[model samples]
Target: MTETRHPMTGNEMSPESAGGMERHAYDVVVVGAGGAGLRAAIAAHDAGARVAVVCKSLLGKAHTVMAEGGIAAAMGNRWPEDNWEVHFRDTMRGGKMLNHWRMAQLHAQQAPERVMELEDWGALFDRTDDGLISQRDFGGHRYARLAHVGDRTGLEMIRTLQQRTVQLGIDVFMELTVTDLFQDDGRISGAFGYWRETGRFVLFEAPAVILATGGIGKSFKVTSNSWEYTGDGHALALRAGASLINMEFVQFHPTGMVWPPSVKGLLVTESVRGDGGVLKNSEGTRFMFDYIPDFFRAETADTEEEADRWYDDKKNNRRPPELLPRDEVARAINSEIKAGRGTPHGGIYLDIASRRTPEFIRKRLPSMYHQFKELADVDITAEPMEIGPTCHYVMGGVEVDPDTQESAVTGLYAVGECSGGMHGSNRLGGNSLGDLLVFGKLAGEAATAYATGLGRARPAVAEDDLRAASHSAVAPFEVEGGDNPYAIQSDLQQSMNDLVGIIRTAGELERSLVEIEALKERARSMAVEGHRQYNPGWHLALDLRNMLLVSESIARAALAREESRGGHTRDDFPQTDHEVWGRKNLVVSLDAAGTGVELSERPLPEMPDELKKYFDEPRKES
Candidate 1:
């Protein structure tokens, strides 16, 4: 509530003697300015709460802006028969039914209205011939269900949300990274972070804090994620006493650019296939047909002719196997590369230019046309793209109550990719955008209601706790000699990539645990040079803690879930054990001593008979 001078610079800032933080007070504090954070802030403000959104990056640079696919919503625009019930079935089956049925139902039921809300707030979606929002085809969905822009849906979505937040007068704190969440009497009250530019500490005092800080993809070497995807929220939630569920389920998207080393792991949107792209091996074979699993056989096309025809007549013919869920596609690609059926690079070929008209290709996927033409010498309208599987998303995150999106920690709510349960073992394409909108709104409203009920009584921050957090943050700079932070980070990435990647074995996972322990030790002793002002090394040092903790949790959880399911593939245990594992959720939490992670089993809630009835009946067709 008061401002003072920095200790070293004597510049006007929060004083060092009293925690040295520029304190801010809000009813709801939302972290990360991505789709979820922005949406949450908007919802909170609309619900009559004082709201603020904080992020470590500039407003538009969040990972959500890099999204290429559309927002999945069963709006019945392209397919009038498409409805929420059908959407719910697709989502549950796509998730392999590992989701909290209530969460999946809420998302499916609310996503349509959320998308329409974006339109009402000024998002100009691509339209159909009848002037309705045009929906496109995506894997695992029965209807053409994704409402997108021309390969830039994320850009448009972020732009709209950002505009809405600004128009509603929500405060934004850009380039600030929170290191620890503060609790008072077992309730989440505030957070401790510092400015990315100056490294001066900042404190946010709020009744509710929304953890929308996204996922942990940066821990993998070949990932489509940006630098900010360090699992900050996941680690913060764990440290603040919230459990993580399904930590082993990390999604490896099948179509990532693989030609040039520089562009490796860059995402190739699913919209390419939605608009009629095909996958091929060096032998000119549509390999997806051979890789189709028995689970999806009834719904997928068996031949290339039928697959091609289904694109035009989806109602009568089954969809292509290329439209199978991401886990299946990624595994198929990995197998092809391992079996020597890959292209010149260690990836397979995705040929769209050979099939679609150049004009249509340019219109439907403008960004892809440019990205391929500029990055690689190949023209997407005339040549195939070198594509492979890449680490894209983690379906695991802070476990929350399905109804409120509130974590076990009373005032700490999580949504978007940072919150678990909505997308079970693996997420379907286009679902991420919809998930953000639906849950972000719910979390925002819930957090607001909780904050309002708390009244004018502010949660107190202990001086000892603030001092300890401050000391720990600055300790890296004090060490005279230690391991380099960047080296440790790079090593952690390689470890996850090689050992805990798409295909895993018992031996490999065991080795990964040993390696992760060493990495954590190195991170703990890592030192940084230079004063705190805009120092990349110091920033890396702070981020290392969260990354290591999250990586360790992922490896530990992966090792324990000994079954091959959606994204967590176990070579030794090659089948999904529904009898045992399916009935339980692998919950990850800090040990009572806060010294290490503890894994436990909790029974998954049974789906209500009313909702279960939909799945037992014949698949819904409009």
Candidate 2:
């Protein structure tokens, strides 16, 4: 596909033109307004930093609001035996022990406090009879550790944080998409972006910048992610010379809708199973019971009575088969479908309709009921929902120090889903929301402390560099005729879904690389027809650059890691080769050519004896 090139003189604003153009400077500039961004802004403001939160969407409408599973925190409500130590162990095991121990430890230790902080900030989580936050059972969690708000946990969390930040008077730049990071003298100086409403470029000069811009799921076809999840933060950080770790481990959620072609990939929240839904084949057999791995065999129930009993008394029995970790369940469903036991739609039936009362289903899963009715024309409360795997989360992202949340670049930082080495291979359901809150606060504190020590040193930003970035951002729109940006995006997604998807092999990955290169070439010639106001076409055009860059990094990292570990499973090399591939994390950087990212090895984090104790205990009930 070819795009028409329109040669128009530049009306784009330079940084100098932005001088009198409402140029707002803050002590910290946050590039996303999701849960992490809001929390980070609040923390920075509390630490005496003038903070601003920038987002691509309207306030309270971040992709974080779409998360349905609850936040994981060991609050000891459902399981008195649950604690941070147990939480840490489950996280590590769920990630296949590839998780950064220190990061996991910090996340586990700090999660409960973060949950309470949200409550104090006015989040109305479900309450137990005794008045503490109520907890729910989620896949891979030994205890009912997830604190939620009726399957709308993300909405409650984001709404509460947004409200709290607004009351605190934090400056917010809604509907602004960051285009480039401005750096000078080996430190971050500021950033440049476009205002979607006015179609004007804006500059933010700040010594500290926080990237809480979520994941890169939009890079794939059939993802349960919003259009905003385009690897912008990961791309921006990488372009600023920051190293990314574990970009290969992308998580595919097992239960996305799979009937209608258009909305087939939308996420069917895990809350369905948490409320006693079952995954069944065409013959009505619960298939997960026969596919338990040794790692999870002790915790899972093979029988219906045991699974039911376990929900009430987790100490004596095992978890329901439907509650297996996402990776295991996804693989099992794939196998069943391949064996001709799948439903007519090629997906297994996720049925809660027959088992639970309609009132209870409606109360526990209102959004699921609404989404299915509106999008798929199926009443989830009355029928089994057809479900399959869809690209959901990126487990690997920009590598940062576990405690500091600081990347290799001194002034650069990453938090939430954009940062890596936290979830290892497969993230347990409900862990991500807690991960965002805990690390978002840490990133803010660390950045504030660092900024405090170095007071008001303005790094030099070049006008030419900023102008070049601005022009680059607007270049696709300048093309009068060419390949459609949407078409290019569609092609990219299809390519990723076909070759770089759940099960990958060497030949398939290589083919994916070739397809990516072709798509990148076509993207350069892509055209945008509409004006910039709420223009999804324009937004997608800009996001394509980040998607292609991050996709290359992911593919490169996957090729380098020879063993099957975590989310990266190489069919050619099926076994986990811990002796060699296990020791070091793959870190990627730009090569001498300044084009493709170079992969280097960094040592796996050392877990102290105290921290390692959590892993030594057998998960079997005493």
Candidate 3:
């Protein structure tokens, strides 16, 4: 016997038509209007489902706009020999063999289609002599493979997707923040949140929800992440009965702006390096050659002459050491600064002017030139930019089924930076935007099929749960006087920065866990002065809870791993324990009471001989 969908007041109805607190009825509610969310909503809509897109900021101001490097795809536009197999090999190697084999395969196979689709939908990319999409060199790729638009690739991508979303008539609820997910009887029902500008409560009754809320980088004091990245999606998934995997893997991008204290964490696009920028220490040495790791030694050049030759004839020459994956490069820069070879601002120098012509630098990296010139008083066309590491992205997120992108919770899906199991322990450069398109489409299609299959059956929202959620949201404002939310937030960021930064120690991680507990208490006692309407204080107060919880998750997972792997480096245990930690992944989920997170170790899913044979080939030169 088949159970039919329960009849409800929220079927194909507008907010005004729906009764009592029900804002709208959507078959799918896609949170975050960034690359992943927009792509998901578009896919769901194309699948004949009504979709609603909830964005915390304005439509165009999503953090995806900050992505400057090109999107990675083996289109073979530049290097005719490049293909999906080579791309897969590069991805697997870049992740240090910790990536889920199936996801990497799928991403490589499907990426070309997605990039071409973007072009079909009015995305104007840089072009080649033959008029095909132009691809360029990036870290961890075997060939010139990132399709871009100078340094504004992200801007063009977002514009194209946004235009497509509007063209399809997808309902976009801008300036909204989804703080809590509503579930009933072991299934997800809908979500509850508030408008950022008006602060009025909003409810969406949907059978399926996709979380694409980016990363947790803002937890650190120095980060390239924006204010919205406070781990909302990661925490919401944990509390909603979905486990998180690889929570310890946080990528510190190697070349963020390090001068002008006001702009210390701003990202310096990898495009500069892709266009022939070189890194040098204050001693006027090209120090990258001295820092190449053994993993990449076979592929990297041993001399400056060979490296420079590779720039013109890559097929015959080796790759420069500066093109190593982010993890190696970031650690190298950190080493240089610690060894007292750093600039006055504690960063090494990236010199493009000395290597490339002024016209070429300005033409290829307009944003980089202007950013350094305007922000740090450095003319990038004539001088070098001081650069260092900064918290960039988290490779760990909600654990989802590789094929469907569905979480453990029924009716819940995740993709992009908030979902795990794509890049593994470390992400390769230019892979993030590619990940967004490939998995975002899958999550959306899967959620729509799951919802449409329900045939109108909806999960009932329990009154007790709704009341508790409402109270928790309003508690801070009702307290009148208590701990200031901003202060607690600042303290949390500082603790995470000092105790659990790029290079960690056992004692520091233990201390971070302790400080996280104290910050949790501070979060509970948080007080907001203004009304909910346009109240940044109240918003921070709410976001503080998510950040505190996610920070503790990262620290605890880092401690449990007991070995350095990818982005997680421990001074006490500096070696990579491939036999132990490499075979296992740390999973984090809520306890039965939904009050705390619990950790467990699980072996990764296996790859069969047929698929595993891909690795049998000699590793490509990256």
Root-mean-square deviation per candidate: 2.6, 5.3, 3.8
Worst 10 residues of 1 by lDDT: 8-17
Candidate 3 local lDDT, 381-455, one digit each (tens): 888999999999999999999889999999999999999989988998889999989999999999999998998
For model 2, the superposed segments whose C-alpha errors exceed 4 Å read 1-22, 312-315, 477-481, 529-535, 620-622
Q: To one decimal, what is the Cα RMSD in angstroms of model 1 from the true structure?
A: 2.6
* Ranking, TM-score, top scorer first: 1, 3, 2
Better of 1 and 2 by lDDT: 1
lDDT (10s digit) by residue, model 1, range 264-340: 99999999988999999999998899998988888888988888888766755488988899999999989999999
By summed lDDT, which 10 consecutive residues of candidate 3 come out lowest?
1-10
lDDT of 2 by residue, 241-317 (tens): 88888888888899999989888779999989988899999999988889888777767887888887775566664
TM agreement with the true structure for every prediction:
0.97, 0.94, 0.96
Candidate whose lDDT is highest: 1
Per-residue error for 138 in candidate 3, Å, reads: 0.7
Off by over 4 Å in 3: 1-22, 620-622
Candidate 1 stretches greater than 4 Å from native: 1-20, 620-622
TM-score between model 2 and native: 0.94
Kindly give the number of clashing pairs for every candidate: 1, 7, 1
Question: Looking at candidate 1, what is the lDDT of residue 372?
Answer: 94
